[model samples]
Target: MTVQDIRSFNRFYTHLIGALDHGRHLYAPYTLTESRVLYELAHAPRTDVADLRTQLHLDAGYLTRILDKFERDGLVERGPSERDPRRRRIRLTPRGRETAELLDERARQAVGTLLAGVAPEDRPRLAEALRTVRALLSGGRVPRPEDVVLRAPAPGDLGWIVQRNAALYAAEYGWNAEYEALVARIVADYAQDHDPRRERVWIAELDGRPVGCVMCVRDTAPGAARLRLLLVEPDARGLGIGDRLVAAVVAFAREAGCREVVLWTNDVLAAARRIYRRHGFTPVAEKPHRSFGKDLVGQDWRLDLRAASE
Candidate 1:
């Protein structure tokens, strides 16, 4: 949130990654900058030395020194550009390419080792957080739909459902802990036991992080499915995550042969209600209710899946 906080995290992360300015790094015998140049040369073979220097933002003198060292070691060869006789170009030798491969492999192994300690289910969340930080700091645009993933609930995701739902409702609508408890029970019931073939849940991920969720569970009626806990994080709302989650529920319910799908919602959730209606859910009943520290109008919606498929 503050400059100091960001700087502190940078310090911690650099140290954690062993990014010391010495000859000993994942790519040993080559300094970070040297290894970086080698990597660029390997990927962009026969690259213009001037273009490489500009891309990496290295000082002219510093870059000349590194290239000089590489040439002395027979790792690279400087020559004229292929199409132009006068323009300068540089290329990695076979030995340089081999060294670049080693650096890449070592970097991967090091990152894999560092990530091995994270819980398998939490890895996606961690990736999402990192992507978010990078995008924000780099002034990137919001995630596209291709970046969204719909996945089955994993370990700890149910708890995330309860916590995020509770916190968001409280912050947005002044809802109380009662809403949180209700969400807890719903996920807890699913956790205890549910027919996986007929009942399903989806966690919507944006850039590998959970940004939304929904559930389809068996209703009291024999052939009815109840849609519950449809939620999208506020930051991710306009990206069609809510629409994607709702569509998943409908598709799953139809595939499970449910005659009808039902859901209960308070009228205050206008965006969610719109998404439901767009997916062919109709408001079948409405009533005043006192719950979650508010006097809300609760509505019951039903979608005739059989009719919809027709």
Candidate 2:
């Protein structure tokens, strides 16, 4: 990405927060930098000037000035470090703590207002995006599993499924537009006619973005469901999203009184196949077919949920 692009985004973000204005944040007469310093002092245990300077990367003179102002306002207390009398530690006075609490409440309200503009369905994906951004900037720290959420598709998700499936397949497998058309058709049919009781779609989200999707739909067979369009984004693979999606399909099929669930895939989709196998699906049929702009062997797999019920 160009530096201009980065600068543009920085400008947009700073403007969004009114960060350049003094006393704009929480309207508490403190600059954003001063507020940050107050927050650090209020929260940090055994905070010394050196530690604050190092952590905040503030000039010693600027920090000294802020602390001096805080001292004058009776919002901060300076104490000799218990460990070393030469080192001074900082603590917030009661008034300072009260101010900190007010700042904290204002910060929370600001975030709430910002997020209020985001659509409900998009919230999880937005959260996932923020986490990914944090992880990327934090030197590739892995996010915890609890941070991920699988949500039901809403409004625009069906379109996202078709678009992402087509784009990802073409990019990864050289599958052509015909594959996209097929996905579009499948999604359209599912949207138009599927029985809600027997079918469901799941979007696997990480860091506020859609990382994967799977759909279980009513099948042509009398008592079977078809698991279709199972896709986990390349970046989100190895996170067991595929397995969880398949498991959800199986569980839903059982709950819907379906005897079995089936899926079709190509031999080249080894990771997907492995997930299917782990979920007790067995390859039942295979045939060579010219499809999706490729000569490939298509395989059908079936999972018997009836036996599980028995």
Candidate 3:
């Protein structure tokens, strides 16, 4: 089939699926917006209005109206923030909590009912295809927050980073099987024997989606650490991700009592090389290598934490 034909079919399929889902709504009384607000409040009862606004991307007037309605209905209470009298915080009332819980359970059931017939094996494929479409449409940009957060990787996040990295690098550099296999091995090993104290994976997320990551693992040699599998989504590049990842790794290594940090990369990764150099890493070794069906030059770099601090 031609590209145009495939595109047309995709449009029709999306519209058909959306229509099917829309027709099957079991929640008779709650609007979608109200349900969403309930869901967000379910997890965080005392959320600031500003945070809710950002998360829902709602206009100020509209959000105020919804909050007012919810308050009048005894579903939620809004009051001045305890720490900051100028800001408002919203919390669910006891009755609101019960109602929200019921609604949430019903929503979960609705989703399960929709996907009941789909085979388990096909679910991953469906999700991946949808993600690809979203990435393409958004020009490869991943969700990011305006504020910076440094935290350990959450469940399933490391795997996501590995998957996104493999897919993106494969498409961008024509990397073959070997490179993919290497990333798989790294991720698997980390997952199998994760140590919060000696090794950690840090992820930077925007809008609850991971956009950058770095891993710091304890080295066999005492007082040494290895930095591995650093990556930022292509759309998230040029916003200091590389520098942030590197700095985070360095801080982690120091906190772990490592005297030095080491990393390896291909010479083709010029941008990464520049970031490392800017952060005090120096090339210690270089070699010609052939892997992934391509001949390339690789370099090993090291940054001495003690020396740099001194």
Candidate with best lDDT: 1
lDDT of 3 by residue, 1-310 (tens): 5799879989997775565457655444667787777766654445688888897898999889888988888988888875488999887776776677677666666557657767989978876786676676678554454333444565588788778778878887888877878888988898899776678777876544578887888777788889888887877776676677787677657756789998889998888899999989999999999977778898999999999768
Instruction: Give the candidate number with the greatest TM-score.
Output: 1
Models 1 onward score TM values of: 0.59, 0.58, 0.55
- TM-score of model 2 (CA atoms): 0.58
Q: What's the best-to-worst order under TM-score? A: 1, 2, 3
Off by over 4 Å in 1: 1-139
Worst 10 residues of 2 by lDDT: 19-28
List model 1 lDDT by residue over 1-310, tens digit each. 9999999998998887874323366767888899888977754555677877886889989999999999999999999875576777987776776787788778767777788889999988888799888778757766765456666666679999999999999999999999999999999998899997688788887765689999999999989999999999988878778887787777667756889999999999999999998889999999999999999999999999989877
- Clash count of each predicted structure: 0, 11, 2
Q: Residues 68-122, candidate 2, lDDT per residue (tens digit)?
A: 9999999888988655789888877768867876886688678777878889899
Worst 10 residues of 3 by lDDT: 142-151
Q: Could you tell which candidate, 2 or 3, scores higher by lDDT?
A: 2
User: Each prediction's Cα lDDT score?
Assistant: 0.83, 0.81, 0.76
Order of candidates by lDDT, top first? 1, 2, 3
Supply the global lDDT for candidate 3.
0.76
